[model samples]
Target: MFGFLKRKIKEFITGTKKEIEKETKEEKGPGERAIERAEKEIREKTKKEEKEKVEEKPKEKSEKKEAIEEFEEKGKKEKLEEKEEKEAEEKRDGLFTRFKKIFVSKKLGEDDFNNFFDKLELILIENNVALEAIDALRENLRKELVGKEIKRKELEKEIENALKNAISSLLIDSFDLIEKIKTELKEKKPYVIVFFGINGSGKTTTIAKIAYMLKTHNITSVLAAADTFRAASIEQLEKHGKNLGIEVIKQKYGADPAAVAFDAIAHAKAKAIDTVLIDTAGRMHTKTDLLREMEKICRVAKPSLKIFVGEAITGNDAVEQAKAFNETVGIDAIILTKADVDEKGGATISVSHVTKKPILFLGVGQEYGDLKRFNKKEILEKIFD
Candidate 1:
């Protein structure tokens, strides 16, 4: 899952590290050469002074004066040699320290970060991350890395952590669905939930999965076949109901969807059912008529929660659908289907942040038990750990 995006992110980190290292080497090359040249000049100057001192000799001096002068000259030459050796050692140590500093104390300036982020932005876009989510991630990472000092050895880990944090921030905090249902059941006899999405997004299957999950927790629920427009939509719900051994409340095709929702809520109330899962008709988000029908269902059912279901593989399209539904009906949570097969995983990353809603679950597979609750830690770890 998310294999492609994960690989791309890892590659970006490593490639950025290498680029920075290469640039640092190039930037410091000239200064290093200058230091070497200065060292060589000092050594040549010391050798030339020694040669001139040896070549110059006074032949007309007295023996005592010549002897004293010879002793002084020898002492001075010894001292000069010692001083030259110490200076040379100091110069070498200074150069070595500067070289080590390049790797051990490299700081990322603002310009360097901007250059790196340009590549990251393209990677994210190619992976299907929404522009708004990308902008948020960019700002978060910029704050973390720009103008910050980082050791060359620790660069990759630092970048990973920063990216993890930035992505983690994009996901809204999710609540426990089972606990929320149980809590709501304490006061209200039946908890109503309505599912919204476009066609072929696995909406019905996800509803069944949720029902199965609730049933496992000993919470009884009834299925509402409110999707009256689509052909065989009622039969599909009935099939899932049969598989789950849960009763399905439905009317004939072309019946009022809102009326169907109202009937389902009434059935739940009469039966003292713990919850009512209303599956609405899937249509294009751009279709105002369909959106209005969804609103009517919500108005009639007065659902405790409204969920937007989307396909994880659709990426930004799924995000836009969620956003539109949220704008129209105010979705409380989200569920992305086909997550197991989604290699990009951008919808999972962008949906919550874009809609300002929490993702309740992910439809990983076809089984009823394949609905995995969304957890931020697992997501971060999957991409970076």
Candidate 2:
């Protein structure tokens, strides 16, 4: 579904990995080289000492002169040995200090990621990823990749692994809507779900798809045509109900939406319906009166779940819309429509992460069966494969 975004992300990761490998290969860390230099100096000093001792040897001397000269030479040699040992100790201390600095500097240095993250941020913005989401990812990548002393040979693989982990963290969260509904049906009788979204976001169609899905599982549900403001919204719900052979509880146009939802819930309770899916009017997030109406519906219906429907192809707009709805009515989850046609499916990541909610399903196509349960593993694999 996210073909364009996937390609861009993969390219960014590959490019970043190559840059890290190149940098690591070209410049050796100071700590390793410092240790090597210290060892070489020690070896050279030892060789020079041995050569000096051999050159100082003399022959044909009296016992007294030989003994005196031997004693003097022994003292000088001992003094020289002490001086060399002191120098060696200082050198070892310096080497250790350098090593300590390297260890402490293990976190990702600013120089290492500045250029790389700049390019990545641009790529994400171009793909319509929300600025907040991009920032979150950047911070996470820094946490995963920074300051770690990865070997030059392992740089690429290490970077790739970190990127994978960061992406998964951003995408994965526990959400099982079907299971939740099944459990709720036992205690709640008819689990009510209110769907909200802006106009042209495919909210009505998504409602139908969910109803059809539930029917397949032998879960009975009633449709609430609570979208009284929209001209054809009620007719739309009735049409879906007729096709699915499910009951539709609707009021006339210009009716109070909250009353329609209340009636729907009451009907579901009396009929022992498994669920009551309430479809609300498509309203702009900026419209205060419309948002108030939504609040009234929430208060009156007391829905078990509030779902926000959005168009994945709308990109950042969808994210903003979802946020606005959540702020006003507090959504429990999300459903993204038109995923099959959305090349840059940044809205999916943006909405879920920004709102701290799970995406229940993806509308991949126009057919009722095109609804796909949101799977974090499958989505990540598709993007990174």
Candidate 3:
């Protein structure tokens, strides 16, 4: 049957080639009749092929079954001849490959904690962590480590713990929401949160994001466009209000931002809004007039919290900005914006440690819901690990 099939296929190949040649010649000559004849022949040949295939199915299946059984017997023999140690060795190697990046030629040396610390310090420095911060970090790490023998097996976890300890030490303990709310309730009207930051640090956006977060937690806030500079500031705050379904009070460009803040606080108090987020102008902390304007806004609003917005990506400049604002308005806390970018590589730790203000939150993205409560553990894991 195999020989007959081969002979048939060869004949079919030659016949098909001849047919194609004939069709091409016919196209150049008397085309119509020759085309019709070739179509008829093709149909007849296809039918004959179908009939032959039908006749061969039972034989093909029986042959396949015999071949499979022979292979099964061969496999059994091969398995019976295989050494147990060799098979076990291969299985062990595969399991090792699953966990290891590349195979070590010999047994690996023990991973010392100090070595891990060196590499981690390098990583932090490479990511633009300030030299002072690094020195402080190293000092803290040394004190914490002291005489501890952190070994290879506990390397991942020990390093994780070190990071956790270091970050917790650096970050100031921020406000308690329940306690703050109760304190504000004593004041017994609107609870205002005044946002302050340098221009381009996402102060307005951070305010909106915080407001959105508060609403999700069932606390409604009124937005204040206290950013009277920047021709687009009013529009930006208004746009946030429209998108967030919150009430926004604004004034014309270059108008008194403090007046705008006063209006929003008054509105929130009158309407019993639980929280008020006021967006202040993006000004340098050094400019006395601009700093005075921010002070006036805070004075008018009587904000429960003065949130100094800082860019996590700004490296040490964030510390400078925060210190400037702290010197000017006496910031209660800081909101680190663009934390998602910072988590990759930035000086959040240095700023947080130096500023001495607790971080209230982190702006993880541009969306209203992207703000996250600053979790030191999460930040450390993302940064060091």
Candidate 4:
């Protein structure tokens, strides 16, 4: 809408510039000298009359001063009231005002909203949104949704789509999907993947999501429980394996995770797995022993791709995690989880640019089906729009 206003203003300015050019042309002609002489004679006559009036009546000057003071006081009051009104309007109708008004006027039902949020929340949380971010998103969404707004007959899903587009513009980067496909195909066979992140950062969950995604694309994946630290870790990977109907190579807790990784790769080579997704323990990037363990696993896996997963609700901590993991293991891609909570949606760009990694997917929700391919351009368009 503003674009239209901007273009109109630009045209008006252009027209004004052309008129000024015409005026300049006229001023350069012979008539301009005559006009200047007439203007000077008129100014002198007006100046003499004003001087005579001032000299004749001192009372007139005092009355005029009193009137000017009253006018100034009235002007000041109006200005103050105008400023207050503007602030109030901005508070309600500022950013997403149009959408809010439409929602409220329509009187959207709670059930209608529930169904709408179900899909949206799943989509957002799976993308690694912070909890607060998601809360902020819901607040904004509800404000625009519950109020009367610009009339449109589009159904709920269409509105949801538009909302998603609006939010996506604030979330991801310009992902060159075609180029990425070509590059992935260049490897020509097995696209091995090594997943890394401190324990509890959703590394294992991310691996499962990617494997499931590949399966949907008709590609096969082999699971490798390279995280040999925690007892539940291997069991967790095994559960994912069972759910996905795949095998998980593993070793005893406190065993060499690097050896487990080597074996996983060997199994993939022997069984001819199309892809290998190695899951490592959730460990702080700052922990040396944990970091060394992750390093060793990557060295042994010799995987074609390394992905770093992080919790989105941790704010800038996710970016910090991305950087540390990238520095330690040379992460090639990122997978952000809990995106349903992305408040500012601010971390997406800073994290990507900081780690210099292409975000592959967003864990928008807790369900395995909630994972989605990252769309970068969609995100950039929303922020600072």
Q: Which regions of candidate 4 are displaced past 4 Å?
A: 1-189, 381-385
After the best TM-score superposition of candidate 3, give how far the Cα of residue 157 lies from its true spot, in angstroms: 5.0
Give the clashing residue pairs of candidate 2, or none: 106-147, 107-146, 107-147, 108-146, 108-147
For model 2, residues 176-294, the per-residue Cα lDDT tens digits are 77788998877878898999998879888999999999999889999999988888888888998999999999889999999999999899889889999999888774668767999
Candidate 2 has a TM-score of 0.78
lDDT of 4 by residue, 1-385 (tens): 1222223323433443444344435544554455556555655565565556444654554465678775785577567656755654464345334433333223344554565556556544544444455565665566556442323333333354445444443343536433554467567545668887766778888788777877877777788887877669899989999998988998888888889878887887788777778887776635687678877887777777788887665656887788878877788888878876654444564466566577877788777787777775545333323
TM-score of each: 0.84, 0.78, 0.64, 0.54
| Local error of candidate 3 at residue 364 (angstroms) | 1.5
Candidate achieving the largest lDDT: 1
Residue 328 of model 3, lDDT score = 78
lDDT for 260 in candidate 1 is 92
- Which of the predicted structures, 1 or 4, would earn the higher lDDT when compared with the native? 1
Model 4, position 363, has a per-residue lDDT of 81
Q: Which one is best on TM-score?
A: 1
Q: What local lDDT does model 4 show for residue 373? A: 74
- How does candidate 4 score on lDDT? 0.64
Candidate order by lDDT, decreasing, is 1, 2, 3, 4
Estimate, for each residue in 58-125, the C-alpha lDDT of model 3 and write its tens digit.
45554656777767855764554455435545655564444332211112123333554565565566
